[model samples]
Target: MLQDTFNLMPLWAFVAACGVTLVAGFVKGAIGFAMPLVMISGLSIFLDPLVAVAGIVLPIVMSNLLQVMRFSWAEARAALREFWRYIAVICVMILIAAQFVTMIPTQTFYLVLGVPVVILSLIQLVGVRFHISPAWRRPSEWIVGLISGTIGGLTGTWGPPTVLYLIALDTPKAKQMLVQGVVYGLGSVTLFLGHLQSGVLNGVTAPWSAALLIPAFLGMRLGFWMSDRMNPVLFRRATLVVLVVAGVNLVRRGLMG
Candidate 1:
């Protein structure tokens, strides 16, 4: 039963968590990023920190899988071929950094998740653009991948940094979506397996993570519908504003804890 897994969580809290995951999935479907940032930040407010991390893993993996399948297999493969270096580095780092998840203190965990979300969301919201020259693209990809993977391993969120890198390259919208899907989809699988070994995604937490997929999937489908009709730019800006607020609250929690 649900009670056996989330022994301390009440029905109301689980309902709220489903709502949060739904919203997070909607944002991700609309913009192609930020699901984990939204989920981890929102769920942390009510769940144990490790439980929150565990909770996002399956939804993230499944959601990104759906994102990838939206495009043709050929497109996904091309994105993977182009970004192999970055993806490889991220997987390696995620596996390594994940080993420390159970070792970090709770307050440190909050800061690890919060500070980067706040900083990266602010950077994008302010319209700061980073340019990566053709010559430097390869190195930049590896570097960004390393950093993104480390943070992702520790906190279950890494969208901002990866998105920043994509923006830096000035990737076209269509290509960017495929690339994000490829990168995030693979990275999320790594996160799932890494957490499994770290004991964060053990039997009890895994069910809770799996159960969230329903709400996450539904919200994503709705977002896909809205994305076809609305202005993504405006919606993305609004989401970033919310992320800043969420990130700030996370930082406050870390500091005050």
Candidate 2:
């Protein structure tokens, strides 16, 4: 099964993909986010897009599980309670939108997805006071969750928007991390199921994803160790900066393509 897929790549390219997985894992461990962004972007540099997507699934799901485990059940339940509507919108929308991935125009899809990520990350990095008023919060949750779940369904990335939402709320840092985990955890589950239906993750690709888990987990451990020494504010600012840069790259590719 792995032969028809992973064996298509040169041995060294596969090794490099492992390295990329490690780096992506470290980023996630340190920041509690960005693993999917990093994994997909980095792995795509050397592998086919569908292959790259499949490769990251198990690792990302496992990473989010690790994150969810960090919080007690009470904390997880509280996060679910607070963000339930957004979660519902995101989940339902993802299921519906994901089934249509093959029909969406690729370049337009990328632009639609990338532009918002770029804009939101730039606003946050610039220290702008972007906030959602309580009056609009419920409506905004549905709207944002709709957009987020759609992107996640079609592209397997739903992080930036969710991050923007949490940041806008000025959620406490620890709580924010837990919320991210919960949101991402749910999104990842949907992504896994959606892709299974879409045929992106199958018996052949399963081993490749499973094989990549080693480097991802190892890198996460290293990152967790280093995260203790970094300032929280600094880490978040850095994450935003990286997100902006990534968004810009995505936008550029969408335009150029």
Q: Could you tell me every candidate's TM-score relative to the true structure?
A: 0.98, 0.90
After superposition, candidate 2 runs with Cα above 4 Å error: 103-113
Could you give candidate 1's per-residue lDDT for residues 2-32 as a string of tens digits? 5678684888989999999999999999999
Model 1 global lDDT (CA atoms, 0 to 1)? 0.91
TM-score of 1: 0.98
Alpha-carbon shift of residue 91 in model 1 (angstroms): 0.9
The window of 10 residues in a row where model 2 has the poorest summed lDDT is 104-113
Scored by lDDT, the top model is 1
lDDT of 2: 0.81
- Candidate 2 lDDT by residue in tens digits, 1-257: 75776575888988998998898888888888878777766665567666777788888888888888889999999999999999989988878877776665656655665677678777767877768889989999999999899877876778878878887887888898899999989888888888888887888887888888899999889878878898866886887777677767767777887
> For candidate 1, what is the total of clashing residue pairs?
0
Task: Quote the lDDT for 147 in model 1.
Answer: 99
